[model samples]
Target chain A: MRLLREAAVIAGKDLRIEARSRVTTNQVLPFGGLVIVLFAMALDADRPTLTRVAPGLFWVTILLAASLAAARSAAVEIENGAADGLRMSSLDGASIFLGKAAAVAVQLVGLELVLGVAVVALYDVEVRSSPVMIVGALCATVGLAAAGTLFAALASGLRARETVLPLLLLPVLAPVLLGGTRAWEAGFEGTPSDGWPWVQLLALFGLVYGSLGVLAYGSLLEES
Target chain B: MLAGVDLDVVEGEIVLLSGPNGAGKTSLLRLLSGLLALTSGEANVLGHDLAVDRRSVRTQLALLGHDTFCYDDLSVVDNLRFAARAVGRSKHAAVEAADRAVERVGLARQAHLEHRRLSAGQKRRLSLGTALVRDARLLLLDEPHAGLDPEGRDVLDALVRDAASDGRTVVFSSHELDRARGLAGREVRIVAGEAHGGRFPTAAAASPTTSTSGSGSVSSAADEPVAGVSAARAGVDTEMAPGDAHEVSP
Candidate 1:
């Protein structure tokens, strides 16, 4: 109960701060949209080809936007001198991680929803099974958000945050991208999901990263 | 092993940890606070073994290091509210506590402003206020007065005194011996890895049951400084009382 309360507090503060500075969402949304637009222009006027690639394009946008959104979620905390204050509050580091991850997850989900709508409207993509694909996309994004927020905090303390973030983040997030892409591919093919294995893989990635990140955050915050 | 190095702090005792630079004062404090891993000996803080229940110990204690931990991008009030939430408070309580803390630190007027916009003195004061609001039983402050003006120092001094008075154990490390002397209820001197014995001169003012383990001596009375100590250079490891500074190799 206490942990949840603390987590809520941390999450609440994060949401409030994000509300105050909508730059996090504003930056991610346009960037994701541009990626979708660029792909549309490059893929030629082939409707069937675009439909075939639709799930791939949609999930790609989700992956990029989710990673970017989650990365900036913790970036704001460290940049503002808020991380240390959070450390001193005597709250468990895991609670802090969970809170931040949850907020980032919310942002990712919101972004994915927008991207999902945009994909269907602009790309003329056929939705074979809407519900499962949406759930899979969200689950995969949450997994990425969990992992990305942690690495973001780690990178934020480093010397070159912008340069270091993607380097540290990409290798770790490779599993997320792979799993999300594979699952979306399976979904688009209208085949029985070999995607189930990848969905399970994403869940594992989320749990491992979430737990480890929370455990490691306290010691990291101790670093100069 | 350094003789007479074992030490303990009970509630309501303002233990002023004094040592020259490199005296392992901060290291010792960190070890006690569970921020640093111990080399060998076990430490138990607030009934939780440091090795066994470090997490629980962390939940109960608050640490204020030289780093004025605050998020520069967030408003002063938001920072405090985040801290309150981390400690398991509701949003409403967090806001209330933050408001009170900002007021207490004289940052209420600037509460809505970003932390990065604040001056150095304001930042330090803000950090101190956050520590106070947590109301943790054990408070670890490293160089608590660094970067503060005289007026800010006085405000901090009062806060420290009040914490000790209210039965909160505060172990603060400082190079400012005069400031330590003014605020500390009991003075602890560390040289290298060794803890030198010093009398609780102010014990008579409150508790008279102060005692030392091993061959350490206890001083009587409040006004007198700890007798004739060698003066060690700053950052040198030495075990000596407040007035007496001794040097020892680790």
Candidate 2:
């Protein structure tokens, strides 16, 4: 119960900061939207091809956006030495991890909504299985957020954090990208039967990373 | 980078850590605050072994470092409230504490202003208020007086003195000797990561010996302008009242 309360406070603080700054809404969202537009342009006049790759393109944009969101979240703590305040706070590390991951997930959900609409409008793709896509997105967002928060902490306090974050996060998040895209592909299909297995994979990925984040955050926070 | 440094601080005592830059004063404070790991040593703060119980140690202490520790987008009151909550205060308690702290630091007028919009001195006051809101047993401040005006400094001085009088321990590092020398019961000089004990004639004058372990005698330099005395007569005053002598093995 205490952990949950602390987590809520942390999440609340992060969300409040983000809301006031609108970094995710103003900057990262537009960046993700631009990525979708660029993907469409890159596959110019190939509507069928764009439709076939929409799921992959959507997941890729989310992955890129997740990196930025995670970095910005960590950067907020770095500003004005807020990281030290966090470390010195009575809140446990697990609570901190959960809170940060939840914030990232929330930001990603917003990004996903925008990107999803863009993909639908630009790729002219039809969603045959909304249920599978929602589940896939939920699970994939959790996995990305957990991994992103973990890697954000790993890269924080470094002189090259901005450059180093993607390098450390992307490789770890390959499973999320793969599982999410595959599940989305199945969801886009007429039958949408095979996506459940990929959805399960995404769920498994989320569970693994989430658990890893809770277990490792304490030690990660101790570093520097 | 610290080596062979042994120091002890007592409860309710204000210990000023003074040294030139790179003297490991900040590092020592960080270690005490559980923000830095000791490579190999035993550290027990507020009855929590730093090696094994860092979290508990951290929970019982508040550290105000060089940074303001305020979120730029959050209002000053929000920052204090968040800090209070972060330290496990209930929502009601956090709100009350934050309100009291803001007023205590004289930031009530600017409480609703975004932290980024605060002047440097206001930000410092807000940071100090955040530390005060935690109501921790130990307060470790690094350069707490850097950007404050005379009035702000006076407020800080009163806060530190008041905290100490209320039986809360304060360990602060500062290069401002005149201001710091007046507040600290004892002063520790860190040179090359090793600490030398000193006595503040104006404060805690009853206990004149240094409080560190394994260092038996204060160097001849103790007679210098600084308020330090040699450690040769240190153990003689071991019988001082509770909270008067903080003798620990650092």
Candidate 3:
């Protein structure tokens, strides 16, 4: 209960700040849309190939979207020197990480919705099995988002933040990307064969990434 | 409302953290108050070890630092509200605390203004106000008087005294020796990475004729005075009345 309250306060404050600034949402939308369009253009705009690659393509776009969005979620707090204030507050590191991840997850969902609709319309891919795909993708996105925000916060105060975030995040987020694409592919094929294992991988990624983010966030904040 | 440090903060004690710049005084306070990690140290703040019971420690302490922590986009009152909620204070208590803190800092009229609209000095005062709103037992201030006017300083002094009188441990750091004397009940001086000795100004030392307001106190180890104050003591007693002079052995 206490953790929920802390997460709410931190996430609420951050979400409000993002809303007022519009920098986060604005950047996520256009960049994510552009990436989806590029995927469409690169795939020869064919129906079957687009359909076959749609799950993988959609997961890839979502991964990039989550990565970019999560990168700034904590970076803004550190950049403004507010991380010190947050540190000084009674909120623990897990609460802080969850709060940041929550906001980033929200942004990713919004981006995914836009990209999902566009991908289905443009590529004529069938998403009758998309509910499972969407859920699996979300799990993977949360894992990536949680881990990405931690690294972003770690790197935010450093020089060359834009270059450093992906460097630190991509290596750790490899599991999520692999599991997410696989899970989404299995779901798209509508057989549910061994998709459970990949889904479990996403869950494990979430737990490991979330726990590590929680434990290491304090040290990162202190170092910053 | 009494707050104790990992080491005791005795009553009627004025502790100083005198040191060259970047001696980790601010970081120490933050760590003790559960703001920064222990890294490697045994700190049992108010009987709560940071390693084992950080949540309890956090509930009992407040930390003030160079950064104001004010949300630049929000109104001053809203900023305080956020802090209050963070610490689990009631909304009414939070508002009351915010009002008193803002009024105490002479910024009552600016409570509704955005933080970015405030000046540097005003920003510092806002940080002080945020600490004030926590209603915590321990108050850890980093350069609390960095940008205060003389009147503002007096108000701050009174607030610190009131807090001490109520048995709250008030700890802060500063570079100005004169101002340090005026603000701290006891002072701890840190030089390089190590803590140096400290005491109040005496009539026969470096500035005998110097007034209590702004005299340069003798801080060197070579010029020790015969005052009732101690030399380089940790773990002060806060409930003791201010100005209780007593001879303390090093």
> A166-203, model 2: which lDDT tens digit per residue?
99999888888888888888878855688888889899
Q: What TM-score would you give candidate 1 relative to the actual structure?
A: 0.75
lDDT of 1 by residue, A1-224 (tens): 76677677677777877777776567888899889888888875787788778777776777677667766776766653556556546676777778888888888878877887887787876566554566566667667877787778777777788777777777777777787767766766665366777778877888788788778866666562
Off by over 4 Å in 3: A42-51, A153-161, A182-200, A211-224, B1-9, B12-59, B70-75, B90-114, B149-155, B175-250
Query: For each candidate, what is the lDDT?
Result: 0.67, 0.79, 0.65
- Pairs with steric clashes in candidate 2: B10-B246, B198-B228, B218-B231
- lDDT tens digits, residues B1-250, model 1? 1223445454566777777775556655555555554333444556555545555656567777766666666788888876776676667987899998898878878889877789988988888877866778778888888888998888888888888788667778788898778788667887654466554544446322222222221222222211111111122222343333234322
State each candidate's clash count: 13, 3, 22
Alpha-carbon runs more than 4 Å astray in model 1: A1-3, A44-51, A74-90, A120-129, A150-224, B1-10, B19-22, B186-250
Model 1 complex DockQ against the native: 0.40
Q: What is the C-alpha RMSD of each candidate to the true structure, in Å?
A: 6.6, 7.6, 9.5
Q: Is candidate 1 or candidate 3 better by lDDT?
A: 1
What interface RMSD does every candidate have?
A: 2.9, 0.9, 2.3
Report the C-alpha lDDT of model 3 over B1-250, residue by residue, as the tens digit. 1111122244334455665564445544555565544333344455554545555666666777777876776667778877887777666887787777788877888988878788877787788788888886667777777887777677777878888788666667877778778767666554322333433333334421101110011111122211111111122232322122121110
Best-to-worst ranking by lDDT: 2, 1, 3
Score candidate 2 by DockQ: 0.72
TM-score of chain B of 3: 0.72
